[model samples]
Target: MSPSQPEVVAARPLTGPRESQDQEGAIPPATTRPEQRAQARDIVRLFQCRLCSFPLRDPVTLPCGRSICKQCLPESHLRLHISYPAVPERLQGFQCPFADCGREHAVGDCGLDVVLSKTTELVKDNLARGKAEAARIKMSTRIAVRDEWEIAGIPSLRSPSPTSEILTGGRLVAAWSMAENGQLDFDAEVVYHGMDGESDDGNFAEFEQEALHQVQEVARTEMDCQICYALFFDPLTTPCGHTFCRSCLHRILDHSLYCPICRRKLAMNPLLNRIACPANERLDLIIETFWKEELHARQGILEAEEIGRHESLDVPLFVCTLSFPMVPTFLHIFEPRYRLMIRRAVEGNRMFGMVLPKRAHFSSDREFHELGTLLRIVNVQYYPDGRSLIETMGVSRFRVVEHGMLDGYTIGKTDRIDDISLEEEEALEAREVTPATSPQSEFTTSEHGSPDLATQTQAPLALENQEDIARIPTKQLLEYALDFVARMRANSVPWLTQRMLELYGECPDDPTIFPWWLASMLPVRELEKYKLLETSSVRERLKICCRWIMEWEQSRW
Candidate 1:
């Protein structure tokens, strides 16, 4: 890995360091033991309570630069909708008394552990809620087995159709992402549930209520922008129902209609700052309770298994990943469990599996990507507030053979892949590979080798066809792969951008040139990345990668 690589950079590249200097605590030192030690010490400082003389024992650092114990930051423990770190004799709750800044950090030495618990809880709560709702839909409320109340092919029944239906998400609470206005919004997602082709809107007021309640908690600290990694005070949400710090998200929206996370169409109002919306409060309450219960049950299973017998451990349940070159999980505050994940990856094997969410139930439907990288954990550091800074290097690419939702997380059967050739590797080593980066070169790379495929309009092209495109060699199918990236846009390209440059030396601002310290970023989808993870033969893997890139690019572009 290149020690010179930027820790977090956007596609357009980040113009500045985001977050309080407290976050700078996550940067790890150079590989040397002494430097790493110094960096670790510096990182540890970020976890200390800046306001108090003590270290943030059970660190829950608020956006207001205060840290508190998790017990002190209970969800409904607030006396008023405000945050005050110093618990006063008159104060009944841990809520920060500050007006707009109401939430103080939840304190606890599980400090890092607590944050991980929070994230895992986020997933768990969602999955459990989904299951409960499924049970509701499964139950025949009126002597009919109907997850859907609307009758198909008949106009008689007034039916409420769901706007979206995921087979199994832990809790499946109403997915009210932070929108342009308010904290969340609601929509009627409908899906066909029974053989009768009947569908119904699954919008529940209770679910919306759950969202609002959580927002009250989430609002206390505010969120760091997903893009710039800054505290999201007065955050702006997109039409796609995704939120980001206003300035960070707008930069992308201004250029094109794409979600910064998945590059999908954000059908949202650009002007919305905070949307006041409704949720099914009653259902949300019931479902939220069930979700917590289920997570505890699952955690119990893991604990009991550890004490009794070792089950088939190789079967990877959750496919966590840190991709090379891109920081998709940017500004994501490090939680404890994830911190544990980083520790294991660093100490045990420096390896972790890259898995994809099922195509149907992912955060976005466009997320069941065709390719992805089995990124190796490269860097890990703890911020003073106990959040972690982590880096993973891309080692292999993967393809999804099949995908489905298991328990509540997305699951898939995957195979590993490689797409670079001996010659291309030599070229990359020589730093001789070039990009048709200009609009003219971009078009030329696409049309030069094709006899009848000319006059096709193009998108803003990044990266290059590392191969000599004038000829499509029979043995080197990877050439077809390079051609694939030439025409990709939105979310259709397969994984392996940095690798393409590494083997062929055709990357932008080429980092892996000649004697440089490291390779550039390798971009791929979760499945493609998973495939690379599963593959053993490097040569055959390249062929598989080439085929996937071509297929994905061909489909979208």
Candidate 2:
């Protein structure tokens, strides 16, 4: 069958004296027969290690003018030789392993042969890439054959035999050329010939079964995952050259930094550096092209998972500090993982959770607080660098139900929390009131005094309960609250009052919403404000905030 063409790159020449350098074990010119002489330009032979007779790996040169593979030398031979243990050691030397060059040389005097090492590395990398490409081509062909047969209403095909016999000549070669040039050209025409006349139609079922068996054998070798032993979904490759499903790899990495199959050290750093693990792009492309049915099944499962995540309130979470409802939170996002998180947030609901970071000593899953606020993106300003300054406002409170990690950031399923209401009791109490004595008329002018009287209007808003606050006219309550706030040290933080005036404007008209404005403006601890946030009653929130303002007013004396 036609195969993809290999790339051609000009090889760099060795800088040493090429004319003098020969194969390490080459016979002397005086003893060599005329026909046994080496070629004029055989650089590969000249750089071959003297000990292993192969391309050098980490080459080191001996003082005796010979080079060998570092790994090829015995471990014991790497150390300096000491003749007597009692004597103080002043000299360190190495013994050459070559038969004709069994000489002792100073250990520290030897150096790495950089030119030889580089040349060998180039040769080895090319050989490795060639092998990988060949395997990829073979696997791709099997996948293509199976996919086409299934599509054509035939589940039976020989292991690559049907493929080769159908497209054996110029058309197959042209397809290969197109593929090598970065085009997917698998639509080559195939001619069908009727079954041989000698064979009866009765035996077709048995023949078909045999062909199906062969197809399964080839498919099992290529389609099954090395880790899960099932069809691959979201396959990824490790630096150690082993492939596994993305989820399987993530689970394995949670315990260790080694490949599951080879047990090779897959990473030099911690498992948190998962970004270093790269996608197996070639393998992924092959599967997508050839396994449409399997991919559809995988999609079905993923869609179900997405439905479940939504039920659990699973959105991306940002762990940093406390945020409260109706307050603006500014964020400086620069981390690559958070950049991806922000992009997803902006694309989806434009919402994410903001939770405070937990202590380092806690478990990874416990790295954030249970309580968090959901923030809605207001605007984002991008900088020349990839970093961004995002403006957001807190929308609601939520408690995490389940936590999961996506890519490098945190995500969680959460249940939204709302303020507990006094509506049931208030409605029952309102229904019990008599229609004869109206609620407003019962509050005589004597208790509330005249609207213009400073003595009645300037009373502390903190002492008023929900009913008492509601009894006073809105104009009188607003004036009295403003006078009390102006008399206290609450405005000591100038920006607090300035920001409140800028955002909500002077004295909100709605009594129920005024508490939130006052809470946002008060210079209080986040924990205390969070308590106010958790409180369900607007009147209760106002009482708590006013109490704190009065306390601050007393402290000023």
Candidate 3:
């Protein structure tokens, strides 16, 4: 390739660097192809496999700067971790499993064939812009310094009348039980000076002071939630040193009974009276710390609102599941968090990013993705049952790098991603490939001569010979299956609608239990699903589906 001519680059018109910042994770839409991989460096920013010298096939890149074919990765590790049954995400780091590569490294994961095609001119344009940015940063600067702080003693309590002066203090004894039932029972008592107080405010105030005041001594004990948010009443400490409430565990497990924190097997047996609650000393410290933290959070916001007297209280945080290309691609794989996410997205334009957790150890700490789609809640329907169905459409896609976890939701720093095309339909002419007259004959030419794909055929389908079927691309095959599934399942039977959709994109006209047939051939492990989830472009999905279908057929006969 010829080097970029500096004069030509310099002369080009400029759009500001801010305009060019990446707004989405690197993944091309379904339109990209391999032939472009060699020449489309300007358009594609995705990671390529280090071993095969391949550019973004099933693109799996890790933060450590290596790439691998997501297809080749194990289903457990091969697919995007988001749909891998625990926490969900589109791309995740994969280890280089290259034969005898002999290196312990990870590549930041991304989708292959997911980016838009750009020309050499675009690359040169971006490079020139980048050079200008670097020059600007170097030309301008700022000084940095460490922040200072001051620690202070607690303020005196505002008690009414000093009353109960029982035993001044004793060790605060506390015991907690994790019983056979879900309740986390706790018994806390403080051994303090003689205590006698009336129920009236005067006495209640004094007693409250003595009960809550600066406990003469309390150890600072804090437990980090393995998932997001502050600890609740019933936190379960895991063997892997992670702590999450039973609800959080249930949330992550999706009822599979696995630990959400570490993706490890959980103990089915219940814990009985697991440990002693923080002693009186520890309890006081925790309460005080919590109070301080809560106050700190509300301080600035409340002060402003109090002065303005016109702030709305709808402090909703973005909480949804799928993000970006991943969202539309995996619409059928119904996992709980994401199901809730999509439902919530449909509630309005305000949607949040679903950031992949930086560390599984602290996934539950209000952790969330930054810059997400403004999921407009387009439809909401409810019946006699308590649950409601929500439908949403993406307003804008965003990339959130420094994501911040919010209580009860996910929020992140986002840059909006522009869509080249929305849910626009590409019309296909009425070729009329129906079961009755659509070319459903065997090929005189040995099956497998479609230009884009070549499947090894052990048994040729009579329909394979049909002239029209012989010319279609892999993408068209999916569209056909999708259309067929929708037509097939137009009626009853919702038992495994999601499963069927995952297989063929929709319920078919015949309502046949075809997923079982499909699953019988493709790899049925969790990891296989992960690979399917990791796929970005429609073409990649088609390729994987084609390979798996062939594998399935080969496995049988």
Q: Give Cα-based local distance difference scores for all models.
A: 0.34, 0.48, 0.31
Return the TM-score for each candidate structure: 0.23, 0.36, 0.25
Q: Tens digits of per-residue lDDT for model 3 on 171-205?
A: 11000011111121111111112112223324333
TM-score, candidate 2, is 0.36
Range of the 10 consecutive residues with the lowest summed lDDT in candidate 1: 510-519
**lDDT ranking, high to low:** 2, 1, 3
State the lDDT of candidate 2 residue by residue for 1-557, as single tens digits.
12211111012222322232132211122211111111101222333454555455677654334566677654332211111110111123445576665644434334454433553455444434433543443322111212345335463542333332221112122222223333322232221112222223333223323332332334335556776777777665443334567767655653455767768654322122233223443344435544658877976886797687676646799987777666677899999999999988999988899987766684655887788888989899888888999988877677888888899999998866654322221222234333342233222132422221222223333433334543333333444455565654354556346665666456554444565556656666666766665664444455565555555566741
Highest lDDT against the true fold, candidate: 2
Worst 10 residues of 3 by lDDT: 1-10
Q: Give the C-alpha lDDT of model 2.
A: 0.48
Q: Please tell me which predicted candidate would have the highest TM-score against the true structure.
A: 2
List ranges where model 2 is wrong by over 4 Å. Answer: 1-307, 310-313, 358-361, 425-492, 497-512
Tens-digit per-residue lDDT, 468-492, candidate 1: 3222222123323334434442344
The superposed Cα distance between candidate 3 and the true structure at residue 500, in angstroms, equals 7.3
Q: Mark the regions of model 1 whose C-alpha exceeds 4 Å error after superposition.
A: 1-333, 347-349, 359-375, 394-475, 479-556
